[model samples]
Target chain A: MNRTTELHPFSVPRYPSGNPAQRVIVQVLVTQDAGQQRHAQLLARADTELRHLALPQYADEAALGEALATLLSEARVGVHLELHGDEAFIWSLCGVARAAGLLGDEITLQCNESGRRMLFCVHCASLQAGTCADLQPCRQCGVMLEVRRHFSERLGAYLGVCADADQPYAQARP
Target chain B: MSALDARVGETRLITPVIREVSLMPVNGTLPAFSAGSHVQLHLPNGKRNAYSLLSDPGDTSHYRIAVRQQAQSRGGSRYVHEQLQTGDQLKISSPANLFPLHSTARLHVLIAAGIGITPFLAYCTELLRRGAAFELHYAYRAGLSDAYVEVLREQLGEHLHLYESSARRLDLGQLLGHRPLGTHVYACGPQSLLDALREQSLALGWPAARVHWEAFAAPEPGVPFVVELARSGRQVAVGAEQSLLEALESAGVELPNLCRGGVCGQCRTPYLKGDVEHRDLFLAHEERASSLMPCVSRGCGSPILLDI
Candidate 1:
């Protein structure tokens, strides 16, 4: 029996919600059509300052990444970051924020498109996003992987281990 | 904690109230300690006092600690100042870090008042070694409790900010306002300084975790009381001069403890009955209802029953 002791990102609300006491709150929209603009607007208050940055459609995330790095470097101690996008986009930026000295508590993720989860393959050390299925093939190494409930905030992905010990990796074609 | 026998290599009088002592291990090099580590020196007068390690943490060749002779010297600091000389043998507990540096902070702001600069001495070395961004705000009177001002000036250079007198007091409002994100502030000093730092940090919207402190305030003398062990049904009388932990130790009751000044939550004991005068900085107000830190906290008026 598999005990669901580890926390899945789904266990919390779509947007875990930014802290109201935060001195500055920056919400980044990875996709303009994620339909979280209304939800992001509701977070604004008189006391705390809230700013929004949107990623244009089909644009390179490199610019957004650069902007985020600059913003985080200049940000003060009481700043909180909110990311509104798909699981992959949110977690990817979470990595960027963590690299820039932002803690897990300082960042809130609101996955506009849920049900699909990001998994980190242990065999190949690659990340893949797929349906919320227990078993999925590793996209990089072609190994059958089992998604574990263990979530890594640093990696921003669920742990994926080899589903079958006998066949660690898929057979190569002739 | 097991004691390590050490010989006093050197001693220097920093001020009328402060004495700096260096201890060399009798057998081998001492264990390496971190930034905010301290050790309990079992005094010649049978009293133990915890002093922060001031020397470089990585250098275990010898351990240096500064002792501030308290006005009400329980014979611990008094013995060190009056009798303890070079070549004297002493037993000191291994270094324990109750106060530690925040691992992931982008910028570290250290605020020290008087002899409280001891821990930050190690912190400055460690932070510089890591090549991390940091600033040290030291509030001390010139030639009074200013132990290593010259050395710190050479070391910190631009990062060190000193407040010499009441005329140039530390501005908490300006100090805590508008810092880069992922900044962590550490304050070590008297209770009043720590209290003000907490209040100002909270008012400035700083998270509780972002603001750390180590209070050097030792337990004040309190009213005498008796501690009744629940299991053994043995009663131990504590005197006004002795701390509850010291009394318990004298009674041969083995209790795990560190930082006996009451910041470390190692000696937290569940109580079944009696009112307690909680003097510890560790426990919350609600937790004080069921448990008490015996290191500094004490039983009041009635016989306190301990879960043991």
Candidate 2:
């Protein structure tokens, strides 16, 4: 498909001149349900602790981690958290939080696994594994999670590696 | 409505009831109707089924419709074709038209596949009555499967073009090229045929508003999303897997809906906020900004707040 023609309003643009190291910031707003309240509490607690943690300059790992913790903690109440950050950091933090038992069992993770790029559902607690399927409200709980991304100038460093991964495609003649 | 009452006021079996029977009735007292008009037949079991009127509008008392027995269908078509005799009565409603004739064009182009030919047959009838310029491209899997072929051939003569897809595929692009300027195109068929026609028309720069469609059945709904009733402050979670209308209906929200496939536009509601993933075939893209067909479209990532 032609990228230009298939472009939707939410699609990210190709940054030709931008630095590869920069990361994007995403904001996720999670609504709480009975099964998700615990996850929210965990996230709130992690956010409080991580806000004071010292991390690399231009890298908001501390904030990102806190967001993950908040999301994971809410998993128990069926509350889903949205995370916005560089793709890599979001995946890593989510993985860590899930491993830490902050994220619960009902939540399913769907991802490309190889590409590590896709949308995540807080309700299902699952990453979209391959192509995005139809948007669905959570069946287990009624809460909906909204995901939005904001590219921050300060978070640019973390994006450098992934941005370079696609460099070879730019060199190919169209 | 008596079980013995003929659904159609007038009846004429134009063709003998072969393996599959077809009927052309003279609809007495039935009001004049446009293309895509259908009449509801009340069955003995108290259920109703709608069949498109296929006869010419000029001929009063004669409304044409063809029926094929489906082994799995709820027995509407089978009863009409197999059980109901020519003189038998069927309880039918007055002619109602959800698919109206397009008035914005000098030339009308019609494409019909299989049983989809019913509406176009009526359209051609109206066009012939008005002496309007129009072209009909009818495609069928087999020449024998083309119901009413003899009638169309005798009536339309050179104006009708029939193609057998079993021999070759219908070339929509070629047909589009020969279409007259300011022509309005109407198509009905299986999703694949309709999809192909839509894609080719869009690629050829046909105005989105100029293309009309009516799907036989509503396609399955995509993933669900959350719907927040703004006035009632009732938040309901709907899966992309099921239609919001269906979900709401199951939840006991009484929303008026007809032809749930998105043609009637009766299920439209105000969108208070949030993104809507539109899938309905009724309104043009511009109409989507304010209202949505809750029957088909799903909400995007966020919770769609609706006035209803």
Candidate 3:
């Protein structure tokens, strides 16, 4: 016999009828090795890996879009992919229906490639149709690149995610 | 498992079956415990209740806990104080320490109000045995109605200050006036007293970190709010209508809570983000910025985030 427990009774409601389109913001952090002088090569390699995997296709857009009709259903989930390096890379992949541009929704990911451990957001979505240009500089600090490398050799790379456009990335709060 | 059993022993009536009931390990192997450690009592009815260990840690023959019958209690305390027998065998969890005595301090000031004296009594015994400098301020109603007065007086002697609040009030400011520097103040009492002590201690320049506290009972419930469990991604509605603990329990979050009254800090979780109207008697004033007791406190506004 199976004893199934209903963890939550309340469910997310779908968007109101005739409501406007919605958008979601995404962020990613990529770390690069200090020994490697060519940062662009590393980024290109990662972009290739992301395109090859195509998580958006794996998620089954039709089913996910149906689920997104629920009010509690989040449009995007944040993903973090960490690489071995002293410099940390951060990326944001915002998913917006072509009609809604950007709706101030954001997701964060923290990845540890060495430990093979990754943390992902449950309610958010990954980008379905967007190029690398859609991924701009850090939204919060306006840093030029996705990765922020510290001068010190000891400190490793880190990533952050946020929902508000004004405050895109926040440092981890204890 | 054996080690846990060895620590909790058998149940015995330290006073009488109806008034005061005590449980000790039958194996005579009570674990080495600190001043404010508590044990989980597995009653004959199969329900578990956490009780503060009230005896000297050095005494291995038995581990003692006192139970008072609450007329309206949800049966845990009522059963132990009313229905349980002197020699009844009870399955008990090993001793767990949350309200531990600070050993680093040179002087320890312990303040207990009403039944909150249980943990301090054990601390007194340990301090006396170790020749540690300590003072115990016990506040309770006057007359023969006060429990453990005789034993406390006999054991603590000059170190014990009995403030019968029924006749006079406990002047916290006056009592704490001469408190020496580096004296660690530990208090466990009613919410009003704890709140007053917390406010006055900070006003008087006592470092917020040095003051330690524990609550003996849950605070009165207040208005409820919606709580968003960050991990499960579920929004649980909680308020004065129901406790946060009950709300979470109903939502199917398995919180390892023993005393649902906020006395034990077992259910403590990090406040990822949100405003909480704290109703618990535990937690020093300064600590409130970082921690909260979900058992009694309710969210003040929408979507109080919790890292449970």
Candidate 4:
């Protein structure tokens, strides 16, 4: 029961604040759903001091992942990330941001979801795409997995396991 | 103190399913434990269950724990409900905290759900004593049970927000509003609630450092399996309800462990073979591939070849 070795960014000394000339913030806006238009507008109108590289509605969400890396590679120490868009896209971008050594405290995100999202299977250790919130056949293993609220950080998706282990043919609720 | 001897001072049904048991030291005062500390009770049924210290951290006179009769009782909760009573002497491990509050936070956001409210009871008291700015948000399905809501309501007062689960869900988005720098959030509750907090916190751009969680649920039981001590070459059969720690200890092998709930990495051991059903939160992604916590974790099937 010793202390966890998970590094906390809060404990790390702040990398200096309030120098707008030195501070370069990266604004990653993945405006996939039309519903996210207002959020995009808000981020654009919110601040004008910091220079931004706005990536809006990339052809594919996966393409935005590569763009995030290039941005972080060239990003300065004072650089912060502001993510505004769909939940899935924002989450993937957040994962990308995390992979690039950006902590949650150093970023700003306004996220929205459209019900169906990508989920990771904890049992099969695979990703299931376009899965709804309700009970459905697991895309990977066909275990009739129920998407549980358990989210695995490593997998970057909600953990879905066998829904009805006891009963063979019980209808699951949403 | 060797699993400090304790007598159940009082066992009251705080709610129909939730039983609040007060444990008094057989002698005088017990060792001091901070808020968020929990004790592992060695029940007569040979099952060890970890319960959060529901009493205030300042008070060392006695320890209190609220045990909810789990729907899927694996003997521990059932034993506490049906067998345990006042004056019953029970063996309990020294208090250990896996969910200790961060020392310095400009603002504390405490979230709890159902029986998970036990840990926060002590946290709320400790925060109030220090006059720290904090808030406790307790989520519950109405009419099910109010384990510590009434008590916490009186203690937390204005700082408590009771979130009810229904069609018009408590806007978790609004619940976790604009983060103002040094706001550290601690959550202890069901996986659903914790998962939402974790996903939402990140979505709202809260750092992994500021967001902390305590998975206080009883260890999910796996199938009966065997353990092979690699060094000694001894094979021990673990029963369906037995933890690998208990099985190891039963076979006269001493394994160091603290916070048997899997938060502490004390019992984490490297495994040579077997598919480990890792139920612990201690091991990181990379470590989980190789190691398993024997306290709350178990092998999926077959034999777990431990490097112990």
Winning model by lDDT: 1
Q: Please name the candidate that would achieve the greatest DockQ relative to the true structure.
A: 1
Docking class of 2: incorrect
| lDDT, candidate 3, B95-124, per-residue tens | 777788876566788888877888887898
Tens-digit lDDT track of model 1 for B25-132: 999799889999999998776677789998998899999999888888767788889999999999999999988999988899999999989999999999999999
Best by TM-score: 1
* Per-chain TM-score of candidate 2, chain B: 0.67
Model 2 ranges with Cα > 4 A deviation: A1-174, B1-28, B178-180, B218-262, B267-308
Off by over 4 Å in 1: A1-44, A55-63, A111-115, A162-174
Which scores higher on TM-score, 2 or 3? 3
TM-score preference between candidates 3 and 4, better one: 4
| Predicted candidate 2 versus true structure: per-residue lDDT over B142-236, tens digit per residue | 53447777778888887798887767677988877534334677887778988997787655545455577777645354665788888899988
Worst 10 residues of 2 chain A by lDDT: A17-26
Sort by TM-score, top down from the best: 1, 4, 3, 2
For model 1, what is the alpha-carbon lDDT of residue A86? 66
DockQ of 2: 0.01
Per-residue lDDT of B56 in model 3: 78
Worst 10 residues of 4 chain B by lDDT: B164-173
Cα lDDT of model 4 by residue, B1-308, tens digit: 25899999988887778888999999989889999988989898888888999898999999999898988887999899889989999899999878899875767888888888889899998999999999888877666656766777888789988877763355566877654445678888877787888777656545567778888646666788898989989999888877888888878886777677787788778988888888877788889877998888888766788897
- Residue range A1-174, candidate 2, lDDT tens digits: 223214442343232211211111111332111224433544464322211111232245556466556544443212222333333434454455445342222122222212333444433444432222222232333333232232222221111111122432224545
